[model samples]
Target: MSGFSSFWASQNKVFRISIILLLLASITYGQGNRKPFAIEGKLNLTSWDIDQNPIELNGDWFFYWNQILTPQDGLLSFNQENKNIKSFPGLWTDYEGDTSYPSFGFASYLLIIEGLEKDKEYALKVPDMYCSYQLWVGSKLVASNGKIGRDAESYEPEWRPVTVNFVAERETESILLNISNFDHSKGGIKNSIVLGPVEHLASQKTNEVAANLIRIIGIALISIISLAGFFLYSKKLFTYFSIFSILWSVRGIFSNMYLIYSWIPDFNWTLGTKIEYLTIYTSVLVGYHIFHNLFPNHSNKIISWASIFINSTFIIITLVSPAVMFTELLNIYFGLMGLLLAYILINVIQAYIYDEKGAGYLAVAITLIIILFFYDMLSYYKFLPYNPYITSIGYVILYGLLGYTLRYNQLHKSKDTTFKFS
Candidate 1:
């Protein structure tokens, strides 16, 4: 008992330090050399240094609702009074300038960037918008994803993050974005556009892709090892965890950097969206089974069965329904999953109180998962600032802890077998 206490005490200290470091890092990264945002469609960066960090082109921008205006049209026809100011990195559904806007519609966004170094090369990182978009930098169409149109028949929806590089032709530049969404529940720019030095933005993109690749590779390895362990030992715990990890790996590929699209550029967006949702649903089912198996005495059978049934139903709906329909169910799923996670947390805590093997480690892992889950939800809904890599970081730490707990259990079981034989 004393040895266990001592071990747990050391682990607790390590866990606390790790959490503190993670929070400090998040804060530091979130506030990295902040710059002023655009106000009423203009961003002044004359005195701001571009070498410091990439700037998110957030704040108010000239929004022309229901009008797919081009650079020529905007320059010749529209003036300051003709435009409506709307915040960037937000959906048109939330736009309430002159009137309410629905999720489906076409719109044009314009932002004039002032004080750029003339003739210097810069890069703009455009995130995945709702359905389709075309971007023009000073009358030259620089980059586009999918096909943009004024309505559903003419519009084609595609989602891909792109970085455009162009030289600054003048001290001030104009950016025009024509976006249209007819197939999804949300429309308009969903994420901030990033601008920085060409080399800096390029390096940043490379680092992000590399990090995502590493995480996917790591999760894939864990799934493979867990499956091999299951086959060798015939343990249901290993099987459950293996499935859980595999689902997460699939989800990871489809999300964050959308790495799968790089490999299959023509992959169907609807199918990809379904796979994303199905992975989440199935992961919860498998994850709950893992905990129930680990602490059967503490886990409630009713809740376990209920989770299984609900998740299974969700999986079926996601597989059959269209992206627009199934995507709306995600918020409801999150609410249910939150309750399920709370139940699992309570069970883990009970197991730890009763000194169940590996409970302490698992409790910590589950706690971290809960925190990251909420963080991701808030971030997704635009309630909080986006951090693309935090959830991946949390999952990596979770897998490490689970791996340690599994090894610890195996080692102790081997000792028990040896003692019995002796």
Candidate 2:
């Protein structure tokens, strides 16, 4: 294992390049945007009243500076010397008061809104900034994130909406926003905050070209791994692959275009959104299998327990009401997937340390998957700057691991058969 690990360490450069190229190729070829704008039909509500609920205007918000819409992290920060640095959408301390926030340059954001209720209250909240901010509703100052003392706990941006009640004089509308960065005195400042819609809208497509490429790559890898498993199947391999493939295939149906058009023909606008959540739920089970395969322990007891725990939790949330589980389930799946991936990587590392032949390949594969997974996870919660094209990198890794296992088992069987015949 040590020898194998050393070998991988020596070839890290080559492995990294290959994995990155493979990931890029997958995204480019497999997950091309088939429908730039396909209505899932889920939002076909009968009444103007239901649609009138305050929807969060967070999705597809654009940043405009000097009359140009800037991409995510487009603000170039500068010091007193005026050198360019990085910036984003959140509160930052200027190394002032006891707890200063990060500083950033000025940037304006605009959100396009549809189906908003008139004569209703809506809040444009930035959780906490501990500093200063200004909010505008169509050029009207709704609430300014005014400067607050760092000593005040409420001064920080809390993960809550800053409410703004308004009487919409007209039916359809949009919001123009201007946020100033006054943290010049603060040391090396950046902002990264999520602009929220009242209700979660269809994930706004991100204009991040790198992230989109990652998604396409993930999809292609998943397709290849799925095919790989199908081609090399022994009894055990077939059983596992059957379960894995069916689960993801069903999940893909809910996620990809095929299911949207077939199953829920009369889609409510929210149906597609709902299916996206469901895909996360099912992917938890998929993670369980991936972990079990990659980090096989002498005893299956722990894996069984973990599976039960995950399913039980999901079942309980579903029983309580789906909405209760929305954010919570996402968090759960995210944590579980992370743990599974970590365990697999650890096993691969251990295998390499023990001089195992295939551990290096597995490690490279896991590394690529993790890179893609982190981007998707961050994008899902709006933590990372990305477009809504969710990358399927983790799924690709899981299927690849499954395929490798099946292939290894079949080869072992063939070798054993040859020995016996001889």
- TM-score of every candidate relative to the true structure: 0.85, 0.40
In Å, residue 296's CA in model 1 sits off its true spot by 1.1
Residues 138-197, candidate 2, lDDT per residue (tens digit)? 435565443322222322221112434445444444444444432222311133233234
* Count of backbone clashes, every candidate in sequence: 0, 48
Q: Which pairs in model 1 have colliding backbones?
A: none
* Residue 242 lDDT (model 2): 52
lDDT of 1 by residue, 122-210 (tens): 89998888888999988789888788998788987777787889888999889999999887777788788989988878877887787
Candidate 1 ranges beyond 4 A from true positions:
1-34, 370-394, 404-422
Off by over 4 Å in 2: 1-232, 242-274, 290-295, 298-300, 352-358, 373-402, 413-422
* Every candidate's lDDT: 0.79, 0.43
- Measured over all alpha carbons after superposition, the RMSD of each candidate to the real structure, in angstroms, is 7.2, 16.8
- Indicate which candidate wins on TM-score: 1
